[model samples]
Target chain A: MAPRKQQEIFDATLRLVAEKGYDGLTVEGVAECSGVNKTTIYRWWPSKAALLGAALIEADVLGFDPPDTGSLRGDLVSLVEAVTRLLTERPSGDIAVAALAAAVRHPELDAHRFFADRFAREREIFERAVRRGELKESADPMLIVDMLAGAVWMRAVFRGLRVTDDFADAAVAALLDGI
Target chain B: MAPRKQQEIFDATLRLVAEKGYDGLTVEGVAECSGVNKTTIYRWWPSKAALLGAALIEADVLGFDPPDTGSLRGDLVSLVEAVTRLLTERPSGDIAVAALAAAVRHPELDAHRFFADRFAREREIFERAVRRGELKESADPMLIVDMLAGAVWMRAVFRGLRVTDDFADAAVAALLDGI
Candidate 1:
């Protein structure tokens, strides 16, 4: 019930998922790792998907402060870098991939909701650009975000390729200035 | 072992994966559906992931002719449309999502190989564009492909959004002329 206790559970869940993957993760493992009762976890989260989703959200694992970098390119590069880290970094990347995999089989996982929430949060960068006359009023914010993030996902997750240091800058430039 | 029989097995595997998610798919189900011996399927494919991968390859479910349209923009739109169909269409889309989900748990699935092979096959389009002076020699072909395909995957799979008819042209235009 306490915030500290919830953080412990969330951390334990992410750690277990990173170590054993989604298929191997269990409420019992979270319980054991976090020193919380399995009944308590279930009472709070209801199911493995629910538990994982809550942990991902409550732990702020995928959270980032949307940059207000003045220029659209600068803001986009920051956003891309943030996404690159989430898809390439340790526990977060592993947990995110595991969640994506699990979502395929379990629609109740509501991975789309996670992405939707993120897009909604990031929409402000584009709005700012449009207001400043930096971007067209008709620019599709969601599509732009999807293309940028999707490129990272394609390389890091799908291709098993490294997200190089220059990728964020290069991607933003290519998308913004055209190849 | 014959080509015809092998086709039957591959079709059955894809169908089973489409009907049941990768987690639900089994060699026995494939064998039953294909009217093939379970041992034969096992002897050839060895594992479920291998079987699924081979089925995807042998079925040519993801295959498309590289458009030789006179212009690079036209070719890219064609490629985007092809990718959209693969990600949004039935049986192929279902099988693809299932394979991708399975790949996350089973590294042996080698989904990267599938993408690699596709990229290799499509590389000629860029090569031709360069030869025709349609594209800059400094252009990153793989990044271009990844960004375009990534956008499709983001909309179709990640967001569960319908990739509209105009998306291909719009995306190509955005990437080519800058947003």
Candidate 2:
């Protein structure tokens, strides 16, 4: 029951967003879909943004934290593969894209906590690489992280560009080579 | 007169898409708004997707093709600065964000030919550098470009991330250091 309540909310939230998109998502709709009361939903989260953010946090999103493999290439493949898989899989990319678009207009609610935290986590991963000296001291780890993260997302989500395994290998090779 | 006619159509197309989104954009709406006949619009392009794609291309905003400044650092700066300008100065990012979203549904027409081609062009610029020994021979140009473009669009468009020089600088620094 403990897990059920939380899972219900997150599952319901994902489906609603996927089906209706961010604009059509509503607390009322979530409650109706999940069979949870609106008051119960609000008690847990201040608003729909909070609820949605919480859902993303709660969901296993293929692990945003990049793993520390001894080599930079190993670590990158781990990072890129996970992100690539996420984007390639159903609903994750779509949900992410929709959430981002919605956040633009409702920045006060969506921007402050969840979004900043996500960026910080991304930076934290890169900073670790810098500390380990797996990368150049002058290299901007955030830039590297962005390059990896950005390419996959832009291809899959935005431009609908495709990334093959050969492409991924090339990407890993290029970043290591260039930086 | 020649430039103005095309400009009017592009302007009207943006307004229409922004107001009604890509799905709602009509040849009729664009024609009426621009005071150009529907026949004229159709005679120029084959479909609504064609019209929209032309508008994006007409805006000339696939971001700048990076100029060779000898130094990758300077080249990177130039590239980032160019994108930063495009992101801030016009509704370029917004239109792009919209196009990507639209592309998800209308894959062939919008994403592959228009946006993806421009994205590919940027990758080619970097890849050639690799070939010239300016960058690492093994450097994955396509992947790096994906990251560079994705990170910018993700932060600015999705997160309501501001297009500050500092942001671009940080991104450039991070990318150079990390990758």
The DockQ leader among the candidates is 1
Q: After the best TM-score superposition of candidate 1, give how far the Cα of residue A87 lies from its true spot, in angstroms.
A: 1.2
The lDDT leader among the candidates is: 1
Clash pairs, model 1 backbone: none
Candidate 1 on A1-179: residue-level lDDT in tens?
99999999999888887777777889999999999999999999999889888877668665667889899999999999999999888878888888888777778877887788788789999999999999999999887898889999999999999989999988888888898
Q: What digit string (tens of lDDT, one per residue) describes model 2 on residues B1-179? A: 37779888888887677666776789999999999999998999879888888777764434356567766666666666676565555566566656666665455556566655666556656766676677776555555556666667656655555756676566655556534
The DockQ figures for the candidates are 0.75, 0.43
lDDT of 2 at A43: 88
Quote the positional error of residue B122 for candidate 1 in Å.
1.2
Q: Ten residues in a row with the worst lDDT in model 2 chain A?
A: A104-113
Model 1 stretches astray by more than 4 angstroms: none
Please give the range of 10 consecutive residues that has the lowest summed lDDT in model 2 chain B.
B58-67
- How high is the DockQ of candidate 1? 0.75
Encode model 1's per-residue lDDT on B25-58: one tens digit a residue: 8999999999999999999999998998888766
